[model samples]
Target chain A: MRLLINKIFLALSILSAGVGLAFLAWILITLFMKGLSSFHFSLFLNDLIEGGLRNLIVGQMILAGLASLIGIPLGMTAGIYIQEYGQGRYAALIRDLSDIMMSAPSIVIGAFVYAIVVVPMGGTSGFAGAIALAIMMIPVVINTTDSMLSLVPRELREAGIALGASKYKVIIDIVIKAAKVGIMTGILLAFARIIGETAPLLFTSETSNYFSLNLGESFPSLTVSIYDLANEPEESSRDLAWAASFILTVLVLIINLTGRFITRNKK
Target chain B: MEKIFQKLSLSSATLVFVLLIGIFITLYSAAKPAIDEFGLHFIINPDWNKEIVVETPSLRADTVANDAEDDAIADEDDMILDEDDDEMLLDDEDDTVTKTIYGGLVPIVGTLLTTIIALTFALPIAMGIAVFLAEIAPKNISYVVGIAIELLAAIPSIIFGMWGLYYFAPIVADLVGGYQVSLLTAGLVLGVMILPFMAAITRDSMNTTPAVLKESAYALGATKFEVIKDIIFPYSKVGIIGSIILALGRALGETMAVAFLIGSIFVLPKAINDPTISIPVAMANNFGEASGLGESALFYLALILFIISFAVISLAKFYFLKKAK
Candidate 1:
């Protein structure tokens, strides 16, 4: 009876694992089928107004790029403080709070930005979307920076200080350099995360159909437009949404795998 | 330059601390108007955007007498009053008071119900997958399958929403006999979305169980199931629970995954398969057009969602997971 029970349990475990993998395979197959039917080379060449995705693709990159610019420095410094400079409960407190912030609702973050930035500006803009993405990115970047910096050997810092380098200089010149690959991978993953985000950009950037370079104006967002298009009653709009979704999934998965590959190579 | 760098770093660290409190305060103040108007009653009141007509003292007696004289006629008058309440409020001096009541009961209930459903559907499959990865699978198989599962987590959630609406919901509806877009379908899709996340973390927690303990159990002639039940599970229980709660927090705030599947209505569902709205779905659908109290009410929902998720994540990270660490 015990052996029989064990066999049953093992079978259940394998079945569940198969179930998990089957869904992934199913979703990928469906995406490929629907997305490829609508996919065309023109998608990269023309703006959405001209029936392609160039503007949205460009706008999303800009928003995520701007967020990385703001988030990387601030998050790295904060992470440095937590790992190197912080002494006791205060550092631990910040670490805990950052983790909590990392999990805070993205839509609530959207609402918060809408309340502060969008309300003050009197309209949605690319800047608001970037800020929301930055807020999301900061905690993730901090998490990566904190963990990567922790992995740096203590002797490296000690050696730098012994060479008469000041504390900040030692950290900048040695500690960060030592952990560069891991931090880069973390940033890549964080970028991958925010680029695929739809909820935070739903209201903040509030996707535009036309190409616009002005950060102060409504910006095109691939994810938000996908949501809008998917919900429309027209079949053509949904086909476009599926095509966009396919493109997005491809980008996110490639970036994610690249980050993982870098880490694996380093290890 | 050194002093400037230290100060800059310190302030940036301080900025993270400030940002959390700032979100709380900002949400509070944005939601203040609705808070003052509805108070805690907003949570329990089921009537969302309902108009209540308050008759003047002189007319109250007449309506009461009419109510006693003819119940059907009074019901008709009430319907007409509701239809004309807006125009009457605008034109009247002080004869009648029209109050539009916005309550959160339906969406709040819907949110809790969907989350419960998600947790129920996900827990077993996640546990089974975690166990398979941690114990049953060979190292090569485990590594490849593990990466596949993590890739599932990397898919954008909006794709999940769209796929659930088209391909998944129909099969579900056919199986369960309900509307294509419904609470059951939304919750199940949410389960599918969170399954890989929950499995990945749980597998990590299970892997933390020392190999020596498992080897000892096996040497004692214990079956694999016995070893897992007696050794690894007992060792990693807290970490596993923490991972589950963390996944719970993620499920709670998910907007797009639930938005397309939840049917986006304010009615309280009487059955598991009924169409309903969740808080995030409500805010996502209505925030664009809502104004004045309507907008404030959405902010109120946002504030509630933020607070609930905040507390849940903190409990997971600081309490259960802290112990595991």
Candidate 2:
């Protein structure tokens, strides 16, 4: 009787897990059915009003890339500081502030940028959007860097110091190399997050029906365009929205998979 | 050279302070025009349109100027509107804006209502799955089930939104015999969305209960149910509560999926079947049409959302810190 009950319970676990997976599968299938109908090379080459997501695609890549570039180094440095040299009251305050920033609403980050960068700069420029995305990126990188640095064997650091290495040299060579894969994972995950963000770009980076390469100009990202198009009354716009959503999702998933791959490869 | 490098590092650390200052300065300046126009009452009062008409004189001056000096007077008058007007406007607009801002309350309430309902439904099922995996599930099946549950966390929110829109809404409406885009349907869909987070967290928490606790309970001739109730549940209480709070945080901030599923309406709902707007949904709904004061109003709404998420996340952080200590 006990054995039979155990078997039933095991089946229940599998059943529950199956239910969750099935829901995810259903969601993906629906996106493909709606979005794939519009899939074409032209969708990647033309501007939105010109019947493609070309500008949006480029804008998203550039802005998110810039955000990652700026955010990763600062966050890693802060993380290293907290994990290595930090102690007492100041470190505690920095840690708490980073936590608060991490879970602050995405839209608030947008508002903060709108107030700070976009408003002061005189318009909703891509640079303002990048700043907002960078804000989102910072907390993720900080957490990952801290964790990765913490995981480095203490003996490794001591050994570096014993070999006549300065504290700076020890961090750059021994500690950073040891935590490289984990730090990379954090960066990829941060990229995945900023890529799908729609709110911040709405206020700080949105462009209307025009294509330009200027960083100071407002440029619509794929996520913002998808959001705008989805709300339109036109069927064509809605279809395009689905396609944009699909593209964004696929891009993020690819980043997530790459992060997973990097972590797994290191292991 | 070493001193130069240290100075460089210190300056870079100073950049974090610079970034924070930059953020504050930008918010203050961007909000300046509206802030100057509204004064302190801007946040409290909701009458966003304080219309000050600027009459540019047509070069053909025969058109009557109410006063020849009224143009400059109007500019000065715009500045000189009495604190009394501000006070009265505050009373009237405060209620209205509060309604619109709180107009989100229906959605907020609906979201909370649905989340509770989802948790009510999901908790027992999640607990059952956790118990099964920890104590009863065969080792091979357990690994597969665990991997599958973890994968659910990886699924993007937009996909969930699309699925809810195309598939779940209609079926839920048919089965539940109510409005197609009611709270119940949103709740059910969100239940599915949150189940993975709850299940995985709960399972880990349950598994972490020292083996000796459960073993001792079982040796005392406790049945499986008794063991779960007396030993496992008590042991994992803090973690279980923390997991639930984390899940609630996710549900609160969830934008795309809930936006698609919950029919976005600005008014408060008197019934569960009524379409409602959540804070995130309200932000999305207004983003397309927002201009001028309408745009600032949306920013205000976003600020409120930031407050809600900030509060919840801080709570979670506090719990984690306590546990860590």
Q: Compose the digit string of candidate 1's lDDT tens values, residues A112-210.
A: 999999989999999999999999999999899999999999999999999999999999999999999999999999999999999998889999999
lDDT for A223 in candidate 1 is 95
lDDT by residue for model 2 (B190-298), tens: 7777777778887887787898988898898876766776787788777777677777777777776677777876555567666766667766667556666556555
Candidate 1 CAPRI classification by DockQ: high
Candidate 2 deviant stretches above 4 angstroms: A1-16, A207-211, B1-148, B177-179, B211-227, B287-300
DockQ of each: 0.83, 0.32
DockQ of 1: 0.83
Query: For candidate 1, lDDT tens digit of each residue in B1-325?
Result: 8898888888889999999999999999999998877778789877788876656556776776564443334334455676777787777647765557688999999998999999998999999999999999999999998998988898999998899999999999999997998999999999989999999999999999999999999999999999999999999999999999999999999999999999999999988889999999998889889889999999999999998999999999988999998
Superposition-based RMSD of candidate 2 using all C-alpha atoms, in angstroms: 7.7
RMSD of each: 4.6, 7.7
